[model samples]
Target chain A: MVPSEAKKYLSKEQFIHQAFSYLEKGVEPTVKTLWLNDEIQEKITEILEHSYPKLRLRYWQHDDQTVWFLDEIGKERPISFGISVKSQRINLVKVLEFRESRGGEIHMQAFTEQFDQIKLTDDNKLNKHIDGITGATMSVSAMKKIARVALMLDKEVR
Target chain B: MKFKLALVSAALLACGTVNAAEPTNQELLDLIKSQQKEIENLKKSVEEADEKAEASVEAAEKTMSNAADSKLSFGGYGELHYNNIEDKESIDFHRFVTFMGYEFNEDIRFFSELEVEHSLSGDGKPGEVELEQAYVEIDVTDATSIKSGLFLVPVGILNETHEPPTFYGVERNPVEKNIIPSTWWEAGAGVTTELAAGITADFAIHSGLEVPNDGGVYDFNIRSGRQKVAKANADSFAYTARIKYTAIPGLELAASIQHQTDLTQGVLNADANLYTAHAIYNVDGFGIRALYAGWDVDSEQAELAGQDKQDGFFVEPSYRFNDEFGVFARYSEWDNVAGNSIDTEMEQTNVGFNYWPHQNVVFKFDLERRDGAQDGDGFNLGVGYQF
Candidate 1:
């Protein structure tokens, strides 16, 4: 996780953090899951090159805003992303941890900022076009999929 | 409740008791008991559903934890094709590859691709088992990365990301094949860094080509000179550098230059330089791509053999009907003996359609017309997938 990065926004009262989350210096979070249905399962499969392994997605929520820590395989390693959806749109998208030696540029704010106010269409496509990083097409694609899945699920639990 | 009352009514009828106007209290009591039983069953069902939901969350968390232990990830792509050239037809499993990588940490990782081409590898079989890429990359900073070991030379577009479904046509375009000699990799170290907004650069020094110096029509076949890093000669090395600009949302422009100290690795006193320029623009469903690549060799023998200068260019325009279907057409012209100036160059026109049943799986069909050198027309059919 991007400790300084996620902390900067987390302390802005975006969502109330319980005592347990702060007990271990932000080491543990109050995790919850959004169980999948046939529709969401099909969409996840479409977004991922392989089958979406997890039948249920773990997330954190307070009121209408939910934060999703999702991971997808970029090339050959899992790139973890932290996304917060409010009002059925992405308000924050951060590359929490990037394991691949390449495409680490996706973690930069210049790229992740494109997801701001991004919405999912009725047919489950991103409403806004996200520009790709040069030489980092797969990583850019993975981030987009994670954002779509986050918004689609936000429609569920929210 | 209605069905329960009906069952009660039927039971009474079966017991030889039929009442028209009013039901006895005993009948009323039985109806109440059945209604209560149905309500309890529904309540139990809801409780079971909640339990199942909890169980699902537990299973998912368990899967996540299990995934954490395995730092390695795997994926692959394969292509199988059938070609009909001049009414002569043949089929082949063109390529099959299993690629994988391991992440040692956040900033360092290892990636590799093991490829099998033409289905088999032996002394006489028309196939090869090649390690296309096996490299360890370390991030020196947020904007720079260095990779060493056998890696794909970042010379052309397809050389790096040539997964079948990613591009159109049953076969790769011939310009990139004959001129750029894509699917090419060498043992080397390279660094990629961001130079400015939307501008990136790459520089690498790697094992150089060894085009056979023996005199023949194919004396300077750039495509055949790849050592594939198998006991390669190190008498000379190649240096390559490229700069790319992708700041515009749907446009990418790049140029690359490469220099080889000795094309024959000291066998012949020949030096080579390659110049490449490419552009890609994609917006909505319409797209266009163009590439120009050329080589200049400095050797008296090569000049005498008419193999000193070689070059090619191709332009492809495509329209993606949607996420799953697209159409493309390409015009290409290339030569391996431009030094002769006899206009001995091969030109081709190809039109193709790609159907992506899934984003990573594609069915491709194409027709090609060749107008120079090799005079033949052919149709190709292929299916490819990556996971």
Candidate 2:
């Protein structure tokens, strides 16, 4: 079951509110949707072993230069995470919701701030090194994926 | 002739001034139209570029998301134990285990554990290799799931999350090992659900125990009845149900019951009932855990051998000086022949300290005393880790 405190963090409205709080002008950005093609969907199926869910990614673009990527990734269970990118640099990567019985420490700033200023490499991996949290390996891995994808997406848009 | 030439020059100068003074309305309108067309072209190019960029980003994110979802995960734990009884001493590589899992999707997955005990397994060897747990879990919703395969019975706290580094002491509590019969898994299928906030319920039907009716070495030793899912007797089945509450931070209360219609797998007219209850509370580096478990057997043959009822309980309190060090003391008592008229109670007291240099690694030392028909004292030391 979703924790009581975590419910407040899971809604799309809450994600948009938090995303705006991180922007300089506090401008309410409009949602932009992107649908996934077959190649990308197949790769995800291979990774997850099961068929991938709808690839319609809902994000917010600010001034056509910054993008906010919000989604849930599975770590024993699906944990909501958000990343904000500007000019190909990760401005923020935060765990918005955590449902696991343990490993809530992945939400702490000490762990989340490591993704700041990190960029993706040409091979579509994080350029900066990230240290794993003991007992929270899966959560840490999920966060890493968010940061890389957000940065890659930011590069493409710019 | 001079006057006529001056008049013509004046007329020509006047005409040139009139022409240069201003453009007509048509000329101004033509200029504005050309600029508007240039602006429109610029706007259209910008719009097209934005669309292309958005599509490209969308493709990149889709690929990355898939890669993230399909990753495989690995982890495990191991321990080495040393024991000193009276003046005799011995050391054993107790257990090593590995955990592997794969996420089929957000709602389905596979998990397994492989273990080696006593450090070796072969013909005429004291050690053995085993599969501790292998199961597939399907999530029906955010709060409920179904699991099947050789999974641990949801009876005791340690049975499901028994990695050494996750708990205290050099060995598991005796009450859990012998009476509750933990580290116990059977071929089973079950549904687990979060019944309410901080409350969870589970039920399973599995292969049942086949206790020996002759009452020899394996008579009432509930530990020996474990079938380990290897050619397990299927003449009868066991049903288990458990409920746990953890609404209060740092506190947990749980109860479990199991019923086997025939402990001898129908070979003898016997049935068994097992019940267990436990509570654990921790706050501000101080903690306490208490548990009670019992088994009742209904069989003339079992009663004749004085192996009808068995029970045990233990209480442990501990204090952690810091993240790196902690100490605890535990008292436990049990009677495997509670049906007998004789005094068959056995008791034990243990005190131990654990030092963890890292969250996943621990060094342990403990002293224990036993009181019963066969009395003994011992010292134990061990090191354990998980990743």
User: What's the number of clashes in each of the models?
Assistant: 0, 1
* Complex DockQ, candidate 2: 0.07
- Across B127-237, the per-residue lDDT of candidate 2 in tens digits comes to 989888888878777667788988888887678767776677888888889887888988889988878666778999988888765647777578888888888888989
All candidates: DockQ? 0.11, 0.07
Model 1 chain A poorest 10 in a row by lDDT? A1-10
Q: Candidate 1: give the TM-score of chain A.
A: 0.77
Can you tell me which runs of candidate 1 are displaced by over 4 Å? A1-67, A102-118, A121-137, B1-63
Winning model by DockQ = 1
lDDT of 1 at B93: 99
Q: What is candidate 2's CAPRI-style docking category based on DockQ?
A: incorrect
| Local lDDT at B103 for model 2 | 65
lDDT of 2 by residue, A1-158 (tens): 11111322345556566656756675577677655567654544433334435556666877644555444443445577777776678876677777553345566666677778888777676776664433344566667766765665565455
Per-model CA lDDT versus the true structure? 0.81, 0.74
